[model samples]
Target: MTDYYGILGVDRDTSFDEIKKVYRKLAREFHPDVNPDPKASDKFKEITTAYEILSDPEKRQRYDLGGDPFSQFSGGQNFGFGDIMDAFFGGGGGNRGPRARMRAGQDALIRVELDLAEACFGAERELNLETAVACEKCSGSGCAPGTKPNVCAICKGRGETQQVTRSIIGQVMTSRPCAACQGYGSVISDACNECAGDGRVRSRKSIPIKIPAGVETGNRIQMSGAGEVGPGGGPAGDIYVEIVELPHDFLVRDGNDLHISIVIPMTSAALGTKVSVETLDGSREVAIKSGFISGETIILKDLGMNKLRGHGRGNLIVHVEVTTPNKLNKEQEELLKSLAKSRGESQDDVEIHHRGGAHSSGFFGRFRDAFNR
Candidate 1:
């Protein structure tokens, strides 16, 4: 009889967490991949067997009472960490039952472009998509009518097979997944022709998605359970609809604020005029006051993009660009000369601005005097 506690290098009253920590350290050192020495393999197996027996409370009690616990391991009942490691380390691993065919589907992503108006005002868009859906013929069973999968004869439903081979130490037993069943333990002899035993088919679908206001480019809208249908009719994954906002003709967006530039003649800037400005709502009038500057802006409240999460909309900014009148007639040129002469700027290099009987000077002073009106 082997002393399980002595093999694990732990006391009889050692905590399970402490025991697990010690066992993991020894496993790392004595694992065949880490240690080239032939004796390390046997030592690793001994410690693993001891750890398995001691980890289970009932099995440890039986071993403490001088009862055989090896019977339990031989029956291949308890599947633990050590048992799983054997499959990867070329040892005769414990029997692993058939793997299920059904699994959760994978998430999918698709990008859709939206009109600027559509993004400002929420709109419904029908998406044409191609995704995997459960096959209709066999209801995701992957079998034809009146027939089902049969147990694999090679591994006898165990999903793996053990083989003994000669090594330097002696006969070393190794286990591998059965080739015929591919670890599924069952062969679909009468596979469904539609999905070809995958239980899902590639099909086109039309899904309607609502485009929320204020959703800009690169924003993703997640639709739960709208992605690919998992193999064997498992639950569908989420579908992410990414937004790509289309460019507006005249308006450029900065956050929630919409900006547009309009050019007006210098006469319109001198004399007050009204202009038609297009907003998210519709065309609105923006008054350009007399002597409106070239780089001035007129903001319309609550006329921009709607807020995605909060109340109220953003502002629409109208950028004004005053253009000088070109191709003036003789009468217009004579009238402008008469107006300039009357203002006393026709002969002087720059009209001096007087402050308390003193002439203001310098570049900044000249600039201030030029636009003082």
Candidate 2:
């Protein structure tokens, strides 16, 4: 007699949970999929057979009494981990009954490119795609003209065939999907010619989609029942529109915020000015304060991208860049020199101070001040 407890590395007095734990561990170790050793498959089968008997209360009690449990079965029986799992986890092991011919279609995904402005304000788009749809000729029945499907005669509508075999334990009966019915319990006597008995056909369709405001890249919008129709005219799956944001000429997006850079001449930055700025909505006048330093930022509230699934909008951040006159004429050069002398900036030894009265001073005052802060 083989010691089932020793084979699973568990004691005879071990609890069912402990035995199951050890069995699972050994099963993974000796499984044919994990271990390529030819002998490992036989070892896994032995382990599974032991678990199948020991996990059952009646079978275990009979084994404990020195009775031959294999003698109780007249025909071959299926015993494996799948049986153990089904006993404990409420799952069906082998012979899962007939399979449904019609099933829900799979979800489909399509990429859509949108400009920055369109994404911010929302837009409508027309899309064309090819997908499976229910056949109109037979009304998705998969039957030709006046004929319909008939129950399988071989398996008697059970969708499975059983075979008896002799093994070491006893005679084992194994059931497999019926070849005639293909597990559907029925056979198509006369298949529809239009869809070739699939009950669905590939078709080109034009659909209108409404893109919501504030959708960003990688976001997906789902449209229910807009995808492919399943075989046998099952319910259609959903269609997902994946957003792909295109690069804008002057705008860059960060979350709900919009960022843009504007270049201004040194005079305009120093003396202050108003400039016409082009925004997604329209052109607006932006005020540039006097003495505005390069790299300074100005925020315009409610002028950015729209918020997704919420009210209001984000702010637009404007970065300013000051440009010095590189090709100054002789007159301009002399005027700058005169202005430099007026500010006592002609001499290199002249001391400069930041507006905050910080220790940093001179031409690099702003840089040092930024670091000090």
Per-residue CA lDDT of model 2 for 8-92, tens digit only, reads 8788898987777777677667643235455665786688778866877767888889876554332112221233333322344
Give the alpha-carbon lDDT of every model.
0.73, 0.74
- lDDT accuracy of residue 244 in candidate 1: 93
The estimated TM-scores of all candidates read 0.63, 0.68
How big is the positional error of residue 252 in model 2, measured in Å on the Cα after superposition? 0.6
Q: List the residue pairs that clash in candidate 1.
A: none
Candidate 1 per-residue lDDT, tens place, 258-306, comes to 8777889998999989999988789999999999977667889989898
Best candidate per lDDT, number? 2
Flag regions of model 2 displaced more than 4 Å. 1-95, 168-170, 354-373
